[model samples]
Every structure is written in structure tokens, then in C-alpha cells.
Target: MLKLEDVVEMCRVPHDKKFRLKDHDPGWAGDEDVPKAKRKKFAETLLAESSAELAEAQDRLYAADTWSVLVILQAMDAAGKDGTIKHVMSGVNPQGCQVFSFKQPSTEELDHNFLWRYTKALPERGRIGIFNRSYYEEVLVVRVHPELAQAERIPDAKIEPSFWTDRFEDLNNLERHLSRNGTKVIKFFLNVSKKEQRKRFLKRLNDPTRHWKFSPSDISERGYWDDYMAAYEEAIAATSTKWAPWHVVPADHKWVARAIVAHTIAEAVEGLHSTYPEIGPEKLAAIEAARKQLEAEDSDPD
Candidate 1:
């Protein structure tokens, strides 16, 4: 099967502002035309293979004993962030990977600096760290609701005029710092259409098992979809630097979305300097002897 990355590169994009993965939502759910059955199987199969590839890549990093990855995902509600993490990362070695989901800030979290929680979660050497929704939220959500923007500690004089500009600058600086420190960061925007979001929202509302997933407040955000898209466009344009280019994954077809994200991650991981620990000769000999003894014991029992 063609990986999601390849398909995304080839997907016939709709007429929604030349909606590239990096700029706009692919609007899959409401897109009755996305060929759901075809996409579902393709997405799952690629996810399975990519999972193995991720493990192998991590093993190489373990041996190499250098470099880690930071994969940041940003999207609106019901944009398949959880599903992507669930299916795409199903095969990676757990010890070598971690996924952090950022939600509404608590009282304690609000008291600290914006990047406090994220700094603690940076991946150790040879591991992969995924942020389900991350530091970017400080800009996105806070921008959407000015009241929430209090978290940004900008100067009172410059706050109103340069709020978003400062955010993009901060984000750009942060990613650059990570790159210099040997952590390769990749940002993904799962672009889904407004129409598709409505379908997903409805599905969550109507289905009993999915009932717990629905939130009435989610609809309130839908009104600002256009505003959010514009925000994303500016964010990507302003911050997608050469060292950390953002890939806009088309989420209308979850398979294509999965494939693209996984492939990109696999490629980045494969490019890293990871390798297994080199066991000494004495340890190798001891293990060989132990294996022979165990084999002999099992044979006698049989």
C-alpha cells in the first residue's frame, strides 16, 4: 500500500483556498466524497508497518545513544489527534516513546511560566516525545479567547499590538533551541474541514459509546473555524523554519493522515543517530553459556 505521506502528496486537494496540509483543514468527515472505506484500510495497514519501523529506528537510536525527537501535533477538537496517536504509535517500544496530552491549564499550571510543563517533558536522548496538543495552544487558544491570553507575560505596553507576533517569535526561538540541542522537532497540523467536524460532532452526539466524547462547548468553537484557519496559516508561515518544517497532514482520509504522519516520523527517526548498547565480550559469552544450559535443561525435560 502506498504510505499516507505519498498519498497526501498526491491527494487531489479541494478548492478550499488551495488547502495544503500546512495551511488549512482537509475537512474529511463532512466530505462524503473522501472514499471512507478505501482510506480506513490503507491508513490502518500503514500504521501497523510504521509502528514496526519506529521500533527498529528507536533500537538503532538506542545503540547510537544520541539524538531524540519531539513531534508536536496541533488541531481543533475531533481532529483525530487521539486516534492518530493510538493507531500510529501502537507498535513503537513504549519505553522509547512518550505521549503528553495538554489540556486546560490548572491553577497551579497557570501560576508557572507557559513553557514550564513542556520543558519537563522533552524527550531524553534516543526517545521520541509526542505532544498531543502542546505549547502552541498558548497562542492558539489564548488568541481565540483574549481572556485566556493572560498566560503570556508580555509587557503591558506591547501586549495588544504584538501579541501573536511575539508568540510566533517565541515558538520559533524555542524550536531553534531544541534543534541546536540535538532534538529534531516536527510539527503537524491535522487539517480537517468544518463540514467534517460537524459530522464527527454529530457522531459523538448520537452514538451511545461515543456519547462521553461530546461537549456542548465544542460547538461554540466551530463558529470560529475560519478564524482558527487564518491563525494556523499565519503560524505556519511565520514559524515553519528550515530546521523544523511543519507538514500539514490531510485528515479527511484518516489513512492518508496516519500514513503521512508516520512516514514523516519514521523518516525523521531513521535519520537520527540511534543505536543499541554494545554488550561486552564477557557478557555475550555469559549469555551464550546461559542459553546453552537452558536449552539442555529443556531437552532433558522433553
Candidate 2:
């Protein structure tokens, strides 16, 4: 079976200046041993297996109740964020997993610090929280549109040249704090090709079932594709830390991407060293008493 570690070396973005999206092949599927015709099927099978592993690991995490995990997914439009979340995380117990999709800010959200909205959504210990588009947008989208940054007006504020750099520092500090407090952060950037995005967008327009997903704004956003790419590159480079590193998952093929994502999550949770809580003497005595009562009731046979 192809393990998550098998692909991590290829997918994880190195924390260095040489990290570039153009160097990554969005269509690269794992396991060169598998033939091209059988790769998709094989990857799907791996995804199912990985999901089971993730579910078991998540159960341990929940039972231990000593640690938490946060999975952040970021990508261009039509990059399979929804699909990846659905298929890759399907086997996880819903009680232990929560998913949040960040859209435009509300009036109330605008009133606070940029990170305030997300801070409220952080997962509790012993659970997994997935963010579809997370606080990274403060640097990505806000950087692309400086007008959005103007809304975050500080009292008597002066715009500084290091604004974006400062925001990255804040995010790094936040992740460091979470890590110190037992929340492991895992971030994924679905590396979808521009050509593939166009095809997916067309499919959405041509298919009635997906028509609702198509919007004029989506088309407008395409105009800023290069800008968005640059923003993502810089933001990722600035923030990808050992405590909360970014994985650039090739998303041109949904199956392959899901397999990588599922395995990565399973591996991360498994590495947390969480285990089912050990029963104490008091709990064992209680169990013994319950067992005796049950045996007595059976003997009475009313």
C-alpha cells in the first residue's frame, strides 16, 4: 500500500526560496510502480484504506482528549476543495470532526481583528477541524485587493510598508501558540492547473446540477489569476513553518489528490502519540460492580 510518507517528500513545500509552483506537476500521481491505466483505481483504493486509518487515529485522538488538529485547505477556484474534504475525510466520525468554509466577512466580523473570526472556530482538544479557506485569506485575497485591507482600520493607524510581513508574523505566532497548546496544524494548497480550472468551470456552466455554483464573480476572479498565484506563493513562503507546514497537493486529478490528503491527515494524527485513555482503579472498580449487578440480575431471571 502507498503510505502518506511516500508522497510527503514530493508534495510538501520546502521552507526555502526555491519553492515554486511551476516546478510541481499537478497531474503527478504517486507510486511509479503502478501503471498509468491502473493508477486511478489504485489511488481510489488507497484513499479508502487511508480513510479507515484516519478514522481509527481520530478515535484515539478523541478518546485521549489531550490534543487537537486543524486542517486548512487553500486553492484556486475549481481546485476540488469540497471534493477533497468529502472523499478524503468521509470515514472520520462526524462527532469528532468539524468543517468550516470561510466566505466573505460579516458586519460583525469586520469589527474585530482579522483573526478573531477564525479563533472562535478553532477545534476543541481531541477533535479535527477543517478550514476550507482559512485566515490565510487575510494575506492572499486582502493582498490582491488592497481595498479589502482598508476595512481593517486601526484607530489612528498609519499604513506601514511592512503590513503584509507583519500579518505573516502574527499568523506564525498564532500557529506557534496553538502548537505549544496541543493543536497540530496541517495546511494544504490544492495545486490545480489553470487549464484544468477552465475545464471544471465549463463543466459547471454546462451541467444544470452545477449551475448554482457558477457565478459572474468567479469569472472576474480569473482575471486576477496571476496576481492570486503570486500572493499565494509569497504568503506560503512566509508562513510555512515546521510547526504548521503546508502541503502542496496536486489536484488536477481528484482521486490522486484525495488519496494524498487522506494519507497525510492519517499520518499526522497518528504521529500525535494519542491513545485511548487508560482506565484508572476507580473506574475499574465501578465496572466490576456493574458487572456483578448484571450477573445478579441474570441469575434472578425475572
Candidate 3:
């Protein structure tokens, strides 16, 4: 089995200014020694173990109530982001985990700064918050289709050459602020191959149950694949920092993506070294007194 630590290291994108999406293989599953037939099974086992570890860590996190976690997932269409999230977080306590999927912004959302809506959905201390797609959309989607920015109604100053650079800086600063405030941020860019995406789209088109997921817009968007790729590369290079680095998880194989995501999350929580709160003497005494009363009542005959 591939070590979870090794898997995390393999997937983590370094803070390199010259980072290129082509350098990372979308179909690169670690441990090529494993038979192809068994690769999926191996990933499943790893995911299960990591999920259990994450669950235990979450328990301590909730009891400690000192830190929160924010998981940000960004990916191209048909990258299996939803499936990866469902499988990796299946074991977590729903009460302690919240997921927000950012789609087309509401008029009210567009009126505020790009980060406002996201800030409102941030996890409270001791919980895990997941952003299905996040503020990076401003850079990725809006950058790809500049017309979208017109909706935000920013002044003509937005057309300046430094506009994108400014957005990236804003994102990095927001994450830094979150980190300093006890929110651990984990970002994943599910790197799916264009070829695999096409295959998945075809599958969705053919399957009645999945037809709803297929849209005419999906086909239209594919025409801008290269533009989106360039946007992703630049945004990631600019925003991936020490406080919240992006994990470029190879997502052509759903199993591999799920395993890496589960492991990364578990390792992050475990690294916090958080523990359950200690009881004070007064609280211990109260607990003992309550225990005695309950025991006495149980022994009494009505």
C-alpha cells in the first residue's frame, strides 16, 4: 500500500511561480507495481483507513473547539469532484461538516466583494467547511469569460493589466488571515484530463440516470478548455501559498482522487495535535456529584 504521507506529498503542488498544468499527469496513479485490476481496491482500502482516522480527529477537534477546517475543491467539469467529496467525507459527522457549492452568484452576492458570500459560510471553530467551488471562480471563470465581470459592475479600473494579479493577492491574503485565525485551509485541484472528461461526458449522455448532469452549456464550455486551463495554471501558481497550498490530485481515476483527498484531510487534522478539553476540579466535582445522585436513585425502590 502507498503510504498516505507519500500520497499527500506526491499530490501537493509546490509554490512555484512557473507551475504548469501539463507537468502533472491527470492519470498518474501512484504504485504502478500494483496490478491494474487491484488498483481500485487498494485505493478503497486506503480511503477507508483515512476516513476512520479523519473521524477520530474530528471528534477531538469538536471537543477541543479551538480550530476549524476549510476544504476548497476546484476542478474542471467531469473531474469527479462531487464523487470524491461524497466518498472521502462519508465517515465524518454531518453536524460538524458543512458543504457549500458556489454556482452562479445571486444578484446580492455579486453586489458584494467576491469573498463576502464565502466568508459568511465559513465553518465555526471546531467544524469542517467545504467549498465545492470557491472565490477562485472570480479568477478562473471570470478570467475565462471576462464578460462575467460586467455583472459585478466594477469600474473600468478592472481592465488594468494588474487586475488578475490583484485578485490573486487578495485570495492569498484571505487564506493567510484564515490560517492565523485557527482555520486550516486545504485546497484541491482535481486534475482531470480533457480526454477523460470527454469520456465521462459521453457516459453521462448515454445513461438515463445521469442525463440531468449533462447540459448544452457543458458542450459550449468545452470550446474554452484551453483558456480555462491557462486560467487555472495562473491562478494556482499565484495563490498556492504555505498557509494553504493546492493539492493537484490526479482525478482521471476516481478511486485515486478519493483516496488522496481522504488522506490529505486526515493528515491535516491529525497535524493539529488537538485534544479534548481538560476538566477543571469544579467540573469534575459536579460530574461526580451528578453520577452519585443518578446511582443513588437507581438503587432506591419506588
Candidate 4:
């Protein structure tokens, strides 16, 4: 079994202002002790163990009803965010988890503050909320294309030097607020290499079934790769806090990314130290009475 500490240490971004996107290797698989040929199986084993732990922790979280978890995933196209989420969270009860994919904003959504739509979708206590792409988009995609911000039509919405900085502060404050209110926020950036992304994009174009996943816009965005990288570096550095931190998971190997994500989530939920709610004396007595009545009914000839 992979130690949670090891997995976290491999993926968690430090809470420092000098975080650099280039420092992390998108193709990292884990310790060099594991031979390349065996890494896939090792990742599967780690994922299975972590999935079991996450399921148990989720049960405790639901019973305690004291805290909620918010998982945020950000990645370039074809980085396997959907697959990671699918595999890592496969064991969780659907009723206790909600997954929201934020796409193009509606007219109604654009009218509200950038954070308003996301705030409304936060998970209530006892549930886990997953944001496939979230408010971080305001800093990322908007930074790459300044035209989108202007489209919001905010009064005096100037693309000044401090614009990105102000948005980062807003994100930090919002996460701190959520933390204070018993919501644990965890973010992940699935770091994929440009070469790997190109390979995947080509595979999609060649495969008939995956053709649906291809979009002209996806290729268009590739032109802004450097811009997106700078934006991600700045956003992650400014927002990774004690209350919430970003995990830069290498995405070249799908199994490795899934395993790390599963382990990290299980660790966070376990850290909550949640337990089943204690039954009061009156409730216990009522339960005993109902149990006796049920036994009597079962024993009766009628």
C-alpha cells in the first residue's frame, strides 16, 4: 500500500508565494523503486486501498453531518479530469456526492458576480462536492482571454495590472470563509505535458468514438498554452493557503493521477475525525422499544 504521506508529498503544492509550474514533472509516476513495467499494477493496488478508505470516511462524514468536502479539479483539455474523478470516486455513494461541471456561463450566470454561481452549488454538511472546473476559471481562462472578463460588463472592470491579483485575493477569502464554516476545500491541477496532450488530441481525432470529444476550440486554446501556464502558476501560488491547498498531480499516467487523488481525498476526510452521531438516552430507549415490538410481532403466530 502506498503511504498517504508519500502520495501527498509527491503531489501537494507548498504554501509558498514562489510556486513555479515548471518545477513539477507532469510525467512523474512515483518512487524510482517501482520499476516502470510494474508501476501500473502498483497504482491500481494503491487506488483500491485508498478507495476503500475513502468510502469508510465518507460514511462517517455522512453520519456525523458536521462537515462538507469540496474537491476542485483544474486541468488543460485531455488531461483526464473526468476519468480521474470517475475512478477515484467510484466507491462513494452518489447521494452523498455531487459533481458539477462548469462550462460556458449562461446569461443569468454572467449577470451575477463571478463567485455567485459557484457559491450556490456548494455541498451542504455531510456531502462531498466536486467542481470539475470552477471559479478558478475566472483567473485562468479569463486571464488568457481578457475579452471574456470585459463581456461580464462589470462597472469599471478594467484589465489593470492588479486585476488578476484582486481576483486571487477574492478566491483566497472565499476559501477561508468556507473553511471557517466546516467545508474542507481541496484543489488539484492535473499537470500534463504538452507532448502528451498533443498525442491525446491526435488520438481523439483519429478515433471515431472520441471524435465527439474533439472541438475546434480545444485546438485554438493550444495556441495560448504559455499564457495558461503563467496564469495557473500565479493563481495557484496566490491561493494555496493553510486552509486550502492545490495538488499538482502528474497526469501523463492516468492510473498514477487517480491513485494520488483518491489517497489525498481519503486523507482529508479522515483528518476530519468525524464519527457517527451519538444517540441520546431518549433515542436509545425509543430504539429499544421499537426493537422489542418488532421481536414480539415476529414471535406472534399472527
lDDT of each: 0.76, 0.90, 0.90, 0.92
Worst 10 residues of 3 by lDDT: 152-161
- What would the per-residue lDDT of candidate 4 be over residues 1-302, giving only the tens digit for each residue? 35668768767877865788899899988677878768788789889998989989999999999999999999999999999989999999988999999988899999999998999999999999999999999999999999999988889878976998899999999999999999999999999999999999999999999999999999999999999999999899988898999999999989889988998899899999999999999999999999999987857577
Instruction: Name the runs in model 3 displaced over 4 angstroms.
Output: 1-3, 299-302
| Highest-lDDT candidate | 4
> For every model in order, what is the number of clashing pairs?
18, 0, 0, 0
* Cα deviation of 228, candidate 3, in Å: 0.7
- Model 2: lDDT equals 0.90
lDDT tens digits by residue: candidate 1, 1-302: 44444454543233233343443447443234556676566666667787779878977875565798899998888989999888778777788888998878877777777788888899998788999989888777777787776654434624464877877888888999999998999888888877778888988988999988888779998988877877777666677776877777778667667777887788778877466778999999999999999887856555
TM-score of each: 0.83, 0.94, 0.95, 0.95
Query: What ranges in model 1 sit over 4 Å off?
Result: 1-44, 151-157, 285-302
- The residue ranges of model 2 lying beyond 4 angstroms of the native Cα positions read 1-6, 31-34, 156-161, 298-302
Instruction: Assess candidate 3 and give its TM-score to the true structure.
Output: 0.95
Candidate 4 Cα errors over 4 Å, as ranges: 1-4, 299-302
TM-score, candidate number 4: 0.95
- The superposed Cα distance between candidate 3 and the true structure at residue 289, in angstroms, equals 1.5
Please tell me which model should have the higher TM-score, number 1 or number 2. Answer: 2
